[model samples]
Target: MILLDDVHKTFGSVHAVRGVTFEVPPGQIVGLLGPNGAGKTTTIRMSVGYFMPDRGRVVIDGHDTRESPEAARSRIGYMPEATPLYPEMRVADYLDFRGRLFAMDRSSRREATARVMDRCDLTQVAHRRIGVLSKGFRQRVGLAAALLHDPPVLVLDEPTNGLDPAQIREVRGLVKELAAKRTMLISSHILSEVERLCDRLIVVSGGRVRGDGTPERLAAAASQEREYVLEARFDTDESARGFEAAVASLSGVASCSSSEPLDGAWRRFRVSARADGADLRESLAAAARARDIPVRELHALTPSLERAFHALADAGEEANP
Candidate 1:
């Protein structure tokens, strides 16, 4: 539903984005992740037509943002990090003003305002002034305004920022519910939130696209090798050392280390191996049985998205520096 191809932007001598390219498929929720000063907001602005890319294209639903900015922007609903709101206006009034800006008729404005208020759970607070409402309620007002026009695409930057646990949960749930019908591009610092909500991720650093894929795919791409956890019991420390030696002797095994002391005679070990398309569990079990070692448990450990994000960011920094 959205595409950025070789987009580049600069301010004075500082290049904010450099040949960054990615796509958000229809009915998909994609997360735009990056460290501070990595041009995430700049890229988002260009996508929404708030700022024009110095080079390349930003397209939304087949309309080029540079060539048909109004039409392209009309398809998108943008809720910025610091939601701009009229402090003195009531929630309903604020939504009405937003509808008016979209040139919605009086009847259409009322209908859209009512629908978004209900969707965002702001009905009870509709009569309250935005400044008097809680931060969470104010955020809902901003979101309601963004949805007033019923855009097919949503661009949300830090949608849950500055909210309490309860409020954050509320907002997250609403975003998820909205994603059922609309394409969403979310940029958040909360990695776990992104991991939970996003179908795919676009990792950016130093104004460049560093990685793009599903979370698991990105993690696997960043990981140098596979890891496995092994637990077993031995009669003596010498036997434990022997078991480690046997496991390390396996062809694909790169290194092995004791992770934790289990019970009186049981111990846990973390085994790292080369990405040789080999299943070490079978070999590990066979080796344990040969040495008369009782295997308690064995399983592979999947690399985390957080680790993958940092790895990509670090790689970008090193390449640019």
Candidate 2:
């Protein structure tokens, strides 16, 4: 439903987006993730027709953003990071005014306002002034405004920002419910939220897309090092030292570090190996048997989405620098 084809944007000396291209198919929820200075906001602005791309083009539902800015924008409902709302207006009044901007007739505006207020859980505060509403309610008002036009594409930038845990979950559930019928592109700094909400992720950094795939695929691809933890009880200090040395000397092991003795005689060790290394559990088991050490625990930690995000961002910075 949305496409950015080789899109590039620049401001004076700073290049904000470079050759950024992605497509969000119908009924899909895609997450846009990146570090602080990455071009996520720029890409979003261009995609929504808020900013014109210096090169390439943005297309919304087959309408060229440059040539048909109105048609393109009419297909999208955008809620920015800091939602702009009038504190003096009542929740229903604000939504009605937004519908007016879309040239919705009085009857249509009333219907849309009522529908969105219910959808966004703003019906209870319909008569309350926006200024007196809590942060969560104000956010719901912003979301209700965005939905007033019933656009097919929803571009939400940090939809859950600044909300408490409960509020975040509430908004998250609402977004999930909305995604069933429309295409969505959400930008968020929260990796866990993205993992839970999005069907796919587009990781951007240094003005370009560094990674794009399902969360599991990206995490696995970025895991270039494998880590394992082993706990064992040793007969003497010399035996523990010897075990550490033996594990570190193994052909595939990159590094191994041990923790202070837990309890009295049980020591924990963390081992790291290259991505291509054989499973270290077997090697460690063999080493423990050779030393007659009693193994307490041995396990490998799984790669996580946060690790993948950082690794991709690091790669982008290195490439750009």
Candidate 3:
């Protein structure tokens, strides 16, 4: 349960967030994605009560961030992109200290510290100095510190920033588990991770929301063409050129090009179709059969998250500029 209504933030002449509005309902994980200067951090800061929006409201669970910073913040567990930690302090001790900062009572602090350590897999390293731990371990410590208060909403920026593949997967699993009880807002540069973990995405660019929807919906809306890869055996270079020409001339086909021979006689080709065109594999295969060309592989490539993100961002640039 988080909401931003026409939120706007600025620093000097730079307007970081402009008329941004979105809502994260309970039990949902929404990914925030954008390039470097897209104002994601600024927006998150306002949502967590670290910064007050200049023009609109940022309400956490029901508390207005500006009017009730403490209440709003109490509902959120924020783990920034580069979480600061005390290298000299032991992990368990550090978490306990954080609990105290949250105004947790001694009994509550002790219980929360132990629960977070176990949940974050930090129990084994409970007494180890944070400074000597690996980056992944440190990340876990930061995450553990955030959970000490048991907030209902989590705002995590680059939560998997310093972890290995296994650790990343572990964090992914943990986030998924937490989503059952807490609303989550995640910002990550990793598209694959976002696609896997988030139920929806909000793409921002040039201080505004450029896209918002499920990954498939956004990708489909942004895609202007469908791409396919076709690999087949050719008798000679001339035959390959002829095949390319034939495929390129097919109805709805936008372009077709061949690459150098792969393996031995098999050559790969890329075919693109207009945005409104149906699948061309059947027609391409029929034409090949008419020409007696031996087809080894043919498949349509789905629109990827990276491609959709760029398309939406570029659209924003053009519209704003």
Candidate 4:
């Protein structure tokens, strides 16, 4: 539904985006993840026609953003990180005004207002003043405004920022619910949130895409050897110490290095195991449990996106240094 071809942007001597290229399919949630100053915001702004790219092209649906801003924009709903809502307006009034901005007729405004309020879970506060609402409620009001036109695609920049734990969970759930109906491009600094919500991830650093794919794909692409990291808690300290010996004796495990004990009876260990190019989670769990060891948690300790990102970003830095 969205495409960027060799996009580039620069601010004086600094390149904000260096030859960015990607494609987003319909009805899929793609995460644009990176640390601060990674050109994610630049990419989104250029995609939405807020900032023209220095070179290359941006297409929204079938319309070129640069050539047909109106056609491209009509299909997109954007909610920026710092929500720009009219604090003086009532929540429902704000949505109605936004709908009008989209050229929605009176009847269309009413229907769009009702639909987005329900979508963003702001129906209860429809009559309340936006200035009087909490930060979380205000954020929802802004999202409702963005969705007032019922656009087919959404460009969200830190949609859950500054929210409390409960509020963050609420907003995250709402985003997932919205994703089912529209193509979403979410940009956030929270790794856990991206891991939980997005089906595909695009990790950017230093003006380039460092990693792009499913989590397992990135892990497998970066892993140089077969390795798994496991953690278990035993009945006592002695059981924890012997956990590595027990796992090391397994058929697949070639070596194990144990880490310091975690809180309670829990401890951590890294096992270099032979890979059969299959999922080894269940096998490792079963092996850990056989030695009277109560396995608390087990995960394939493949190299994470964080590791892959560091490798790529570091390479760029050294090359550009």
Candidate 5:
């Protein structure tokens, strides 16, 4: 639904986004994760056509953002980090105005406004002045405006920036609901929010994409060292070595080691995959059966997203410095 290919952006000497290239497919929610000043905002702006990339392409729903910006932008609903809204305008009135800006007809405007109001939970304050509404409501109003046109793609940057705990939870649920229908890209520093709502995550740092994949996949791919864990219905010293040598022969299996057995009945062994992304669970199970060793489970255990992200980001910093 969205693609950025070799995109680059600069502010004089500052390169805010460098060679960014990734894609968000239909029915998928991708998290754009980074710390402050990591070019996440800049990358989003470029994707939304607010700032043209210095090089490469930004395509939204098959329209090239640079070649046909209007068509591309019309397909997107953007809630910027700042969450700008007309303070004096009533919630309903503001959304109606936004719809009009999209050149929507009277009936279309009404229907769109109603749909987004319901989606963002703005109906309770439909007539309330945006300025008088609480910060949480104001954020909803902005979200409503963004949705007024019913765009197929949504780019939300810090959608929960200033909300209290309850408000944040509400907004997160709203975003999750929207994800069921739209292709969404969430750019937020809050890891838990991203982890909960997004199927995949892209970690950015120093104006570049340091890593991009599902959180679990990224964690596994980023690690140099590996762990092997095994489950078995039986455990014995000689039988263990028989299982170990059988496991080591499997493709990508490096080494299996464990001094003591787990729970005296189950044994846990760690095997380093000789190749990246190799799955050895099935091999281990088959080999154990061949030796009459009752096996239970075997799989590689990778670190968490937080741990993987820290490892990649720290390496990025060291390389740049």
Candidate 6:
């Protein structure tokens, strides 16, 4: 529902975004992830018409943000990292004000405000002043205002930034609930949360898209080869040497390196192999059996999204350096 096509932005000599591009499909939650100064917020601002891109287009639905900003923005509900709110206003009052800004009629405003208050679980606190509410409640108020118009898309920047554990979980649940009805583009620094919440990820660094895919796909792209950890015990040092040689000779086995010894007779090793969808464990076990080596542990080591994110970010830095 949202598309950023080769978007570029600059402030003085600093290029905040450089040909960054991605799309958020309908009813999908996409995470915009990156380190500091990676242009995530800038991209989000462009998407919501808060800032115009210097080059390329930010399109929402079928409207171009640069050519029809108002129409494009009308379809989006935006919750910025630092929420702008009237401290003295009650939560319900603030939502009413937001509705009026969208030109919602008095009847429509009341209905929208009531729906969002309940949707965001802010019904009990609707009568409380925003100034006296906890950070989490204030955040809920901001979200309710964003949803007052019932837009088809939501752009959320750091939706769980400063909340306590309980508050964070609450917010996460709310986001997930909202996603069932709207396309969402969420930008977060919390890798684990993104891993759990996002269906796809766009990893940016140095104002460029370094990686884009599902978490599993990105991990696979970052890993050049499949790896396994093998631990085995041998009756003699000579037997261990023979076992290593046999494993190294197996088909698809790229390389084998000895790790720290498990004890005097048992040793741990890392086996690297081409990721060709082949089962190398059976081969390794058979080699050990032929060599009379007793197996202690053998398992494939799965790649992690955290590692893939850092690897792509590091690659981006090196390319631009």
Best by lDDT: 3
After superposing candidate 5 on the true structure, give the runs of residues whose Cα lies further than 4 Å from its correct spot. Answer: 225-302
What does candidate 6's lDDT look like per residue over 1-321, in tens digits?
Answer: 999999999999989999998889888999999988888889889999999999999999889998888899889999999777889998888899889888899999999998999888899998889999988888888888888999999999888877889888888888888899788999999999999889999999989999999989998888878898899987776777777787888899998987656777779978999767487888888887886678889998898888899999998788776
Compose the digit string of candidate 2's lDDT tens values, residues 89-141: 98888888888888899999999988998888888999999999998888888
lDDT by residue (tens digit), candidate 5, 1-321: 999999999999887888999999988999998877778889999989999999999999999998999999999999998688888888888888888888899999999888988888889999989889888888888888877888899999888988999988888888888888789999988887888878999998888899898887887777766666777755458777777777777777778765467776777777776656457776767777787776667676756677788787776666555
Best by TM-score: 3
lDDT of 4 by residue, 78-162 (tens): 9988887788899989888888778999999999898888877889999998989998888888788778887888888888887
TM-score of each: 0.94, 0.94, 0.96, 0.79, 0.76, 0.89
For candidate 3, write residues 1-321 as lDDT tens digits: 999999999899998899999999999999999988888899888888889999999999999988888989988998988888889999888988888888999999999998998999988899999999999999999888877898999999999998999999999999999999899999999999999999999999988999999999998888889999999999899999999999999998999999999989999999999889999999989988999999989999998889999998887777666
* Full-model lDDT for every candidate: 0.89, 0.91, 0.92, 0.81, 0.83, 0.88
Which stretches in model 4 have alpha-carbon errors above 4 Å? 229-256, 259-269, 272-303, 319-321
Query: What TM-score does model 2 achieve against the real structure?
Result: 0.94
Question: Of the pair 1 and 4, which is ahead by lDDT?
Answer: 1
lDDT of 1: 0.89
Better of 4 and 5 by TM-score: 4
Give the alpha carbon lDDT tens digit for every residue of 123-150 in model 1: 9988888988877777778788888899
* Candidate 5: RMSD to truth: 5.3
Candidate 3 worst ten-residue window by lDDT: 312-321
TM-score of 6: 0.89
User: Cα deviation of 282 in candidate 1 (Å)?
Assistant: 0.9
